[model samples]
Target: MSEAQDDDVQEFAASLTRMKERTDRSYGQLARRLNMNTSTLHRYCAGDAVPLDFAPVERFAALCGATPQERLELHRLWILAVAARQRSRTAAAEATGTAGTPPEPAGEPVQDPVSPEPAGEPALDPVSPEPPHRPWFRRRRFLVSAAVATALLATLGSLSALPDDDRRPGASDSVEAADPPRATRPGTPRPKSTKSPSPSPKTSSSPSAGASKKSSPKPGERTEEPSKGPGQQRPPAGVPLTWSADSHVWQAGCGHDYVIARSPRQVPPPPAPQDAETWAGTQNAVHGRQTLVEVSVQGRTSTAVVLEALRVRVVGRSAPGRGSSYAMDNGCGGALTPRYFDVDLDKDRPIARPADGNDSGVTIPAMRLPYRVSAEDPEVLLIDARTKGCDCSWYLELDWSSQGRTGTVRIDDHGRPFRTTGIDGLPRYSYDTSARKWVPYS
Candidate 1:
């Protein structure tokens, strides 16, 4: 194999290996579940062979509990590996001059040749003689022509018997006008058709009419601006931006606290940051006092997108939940320099503001908005929303514009808003790493 081909295969194998390691499954275990030979599975993960079909790879990813994004990345790598393998095979075939060449037969077949007749006389059947035949259409030519002429004459006779007004121009329009109009609902108005009317026969035969018909928009074609009433603002047809919000971020200095309705003894030990979402779900936990979310935004096209501002919308507020608060980490030691924004949920009208972070005595500068992102350049924003008086449910609105088009994208925890409640004076507990148990903290 060429060096490039080898590299592509190895890269795909490395991704598979990482996925396997994350699942903590052995080769024999995975092979049994996948219904494949252990050695064959090993070869695939070792970059010794590539699967001809993607079905097994997809199943393998599902078995390893891979996320949607991870599965997409894996499929992309698999495509590259398959392409490289095909190229290598083609190169080998061409080098041996066997490409597109048909294989030769092993043996030749024998056949008998017929004898030629005498120079002037044609061969005759020995037993009997047969009569000559005529084609079916040729024998019925007169009948067929007569039938066509009779049909044409009958059509002309029928037309001549019609009334003169029925044959006049715009006769069809008069017939339509005699019918009653369609009835609409009492309070509802009929919607006007967006499509243009069909041209009349007189104008339809003109060059300009044909050109206009060709230029008209087809059915279901999206318009840049949809019809709307006055004083109303509508977003452009489509925005070329994509974003995802992860609410399972770890907040430093806050000690990674979460509020749950369960007791300290019922809750398990603190999970790693990556598994925080799963852990929270198992415990039915919500962020305590504050929640830190990580938002990733990227443009789907090559055009740059300007992120104007981040606004917070308060969905609702209620009394804080009466629950026990637990801290995932006893102490977090690291410099916080990420682009961060702070939202105070206790306010009547909350907004995202640039915030600075401090580690020990070093202060980190705050990052502001009006950032630019494209297909090649993506941006991540960290939002830290805190509440002290009530349990607040809120989501973020991101204003963006690209190529004179502007729109807003909502950032939330999946389809629901992020919830943060007051944890002051609540029963607090912390996980002790050495003891491997939850310990009450003041």
Candidate 2:
């Protein structure tokens, strides 16, 4: 391989190692979580191998809590590594002169002309209409030879009539019969084989079939009973539920809050919520006090997926970063009625609870878990996560069940954990839209 191509593979491996280190989990543990071999994972992280499919790499990055930007970069590196590996293989094959050679047949090679026919002793002319004039003794010998050949042919015909089981192994006549030729006209149906068809690998080993076999749970293992009737079928190979989350979504009236590492004079006026990510990056800011996330979920098929519950997992916690809190808006008069969930990052066991609407005095009815959604019907959720004591990194686990299978999908700020920091005593400011400048907020 060229040095540049080798470096690409190493670069991909380095990225994987960095992500693995950030997770703080052992290779064995990560392998178990990913349903892969421990040694395979090691080879990937150690630059000894590259995966042909990107699914495993993507899953590994998500498990390591890589940010969206980081994931994108990792994917690009993976592409480069895969391309380089393929090119190297092709070059090796071309150098070996076996790139497109067909494999030689097995077993002993046949003689070129089968012993050159007994020194050509007056060979018979079977196709000739008349034989040359010969002595009486020669004519007599030819007649005897014809009689012997006829008897040999009769014996061979008898052997051919015997059943296949009685025939000797490796007989020259043991070749399989070929199919009859078919017309090549367009739209003509081809003849079907008389042999029985084999079972499809996908149908026999699909996830749904495997899931059905685990109906009886093991000791101490949590299992969801199949909700389908006796005749109902399971969903296909993968999870039917799909969802997307936007962590940059705005809170209805007060706008976004960012804790930026800059003084009032150094910071610029707040940007709109849609542009919050870029703006925060420019200002070296992190989430302040609360982070609002919008999540939309639906089923990929017609089967309904039941959203059982929303669970919170805290990845890490630290003292809030020191910075000034900048509120994107001074004040606004509006309300939103989308399903809302409040998350308290300071709690020992954080959970998502239904919250009421803001600013409109509207008391939203408490919506409990077990919501159903399908391809035609989708559900949107607004999450307002707040921290009062520490800077927190966390993500959500959405539990769902459909068509006799249950699974959990991780929800995050585009592959990374959603971060929210306490801002109780930070210098707070609000943008004066009329003046287009920052002003101190109580």
Candidate 3:
């Protein structure tokens, strides 16, 4: 080997080590940015292989925010590495390559790593088809964890990949990793600081209100309870939606109009009063972004179509002048999805009206929940029509008994699919990654 070639090997090794240590990035995050994996990253870092693709490396550089000079040098080195590998493989094949040899019979065991380099340089091992695994233990687990922690943010199912632009292998992602990420509704009052440091409310009442004279605060004073802003409560990733049944019993909307509640598998006609509207439908599609499902039911005279969109949004945080902008359209009868509430609540019925609320409330189910609404999906109303309510975990009780004994639909919020007391009576689905689908959570 020439002196220059040997120098190149050492230089490449040093550069790789620098890249690994210089940035504390995880294989997952780097993969998302570069669209590659840990094993590939391991090889690249170890100078085991020059990439056939430049994307992952480029992504890493981008994450590192490499300087112009550094970027240029990286490409230059990458090209040299590739060229060397090609030459070595070519010479080895010409010398002792079994270029077209057939495989041995079934009983044969594969040999150890075969050198593809004609010289003494080590041969490049082909990547095994299986993913790389750590033993029951691994070194650098913490570093790998930090990388993964920084990236691989859990997102909703109809995945809109985070723009590669927002990602970095560094600690600062620009977007505040708030407990409950604070987002403003469109058209709502903007704070002087859009990304304000979370505020602590100033207690106004006397500190000793309703207390004995000695314990009582002055006439203008008040006692205060510990209060944290909405941002203080963020649901951790992968945490199941804790079931919280309302102490208030669910009352069907409108005194006389009883909505039929049934399971997805029963075929019996609901025991309906002659005056009740018997709703039925096929579990066609659930456009959760719009928080609505499209249902088509068959009856004696004709088929009934109903667009059921779940209503969840942040209260008080909705933009002062926004609503309906993010609701999904069911696209029925030549109508669009979220095609406006079938019956407008704002105009007719009594949706919850916050006495202190400045704007009118939009129509939704009697049970409203605070969900990552509009700020997450602009086309959905959760962003525009905001409201404040108890953080009640909810699952729409869908009765599919009209279809079959086995009709069911899994409700997936935040990519973790869970089977709620599935029938009107029991929600039982849990996400089992091992099973790769929703199993009974109960």
Query: Which of the numbered candidates is closest to the native, going by highest lDDT?
Result: 2
RMSD of each: 20.0, 22.5, 27.2
Clashes of each: 0, 0, 53
lDDT of 1: 0.69
Residue 327, candidate 1: Cα error in Å is: 0.5
For candidate 3, what is the TM-score?
0.23
- Candidate 2: Cα lDDT at 410: 68
Q: Per-residue alpha-carbon lDDT of model 1 for 1-442, expressed as tens digits?
A: 7998889999999999888755424565587799987667778888989999999899999988789999999999999999999999998988886865433334321121132222453433334432234222232455567779999999999999997544444432211111233233222222211111111212244445534532212222211212235654532335456666677677653367899988877888887665677677767888998898877677766678888878888877998899999998776765544447988899999989998766446665676789787654456678989998899988777777766555555666645678999998799999887988889984
Tell me how far candidate 2 lies from the true structure as C-alpha RMSD in angstroms: 22.5
Candidate 2: which stretches are off by over 4 Å? 1-234, 335-338, 358-362, 433-435
For candidate 2, write residues 136-198 as lDDT tens digits: 335446867898999999999998998754534333222224346534432344332211111
Error of 3 at 12 (Å): 3.3
User: What's the C-alpha lDDT at position 1 in model 2?
Assistant: 86
Please give the lDDT score at residue 356 for candidate 3: 19
Better of 2 and 3 by TM-score: 2
Which run of 10 residues does model 2 get worst, by summed lDDT? 193-202
For model 2, the local distance difference test gives 0.70
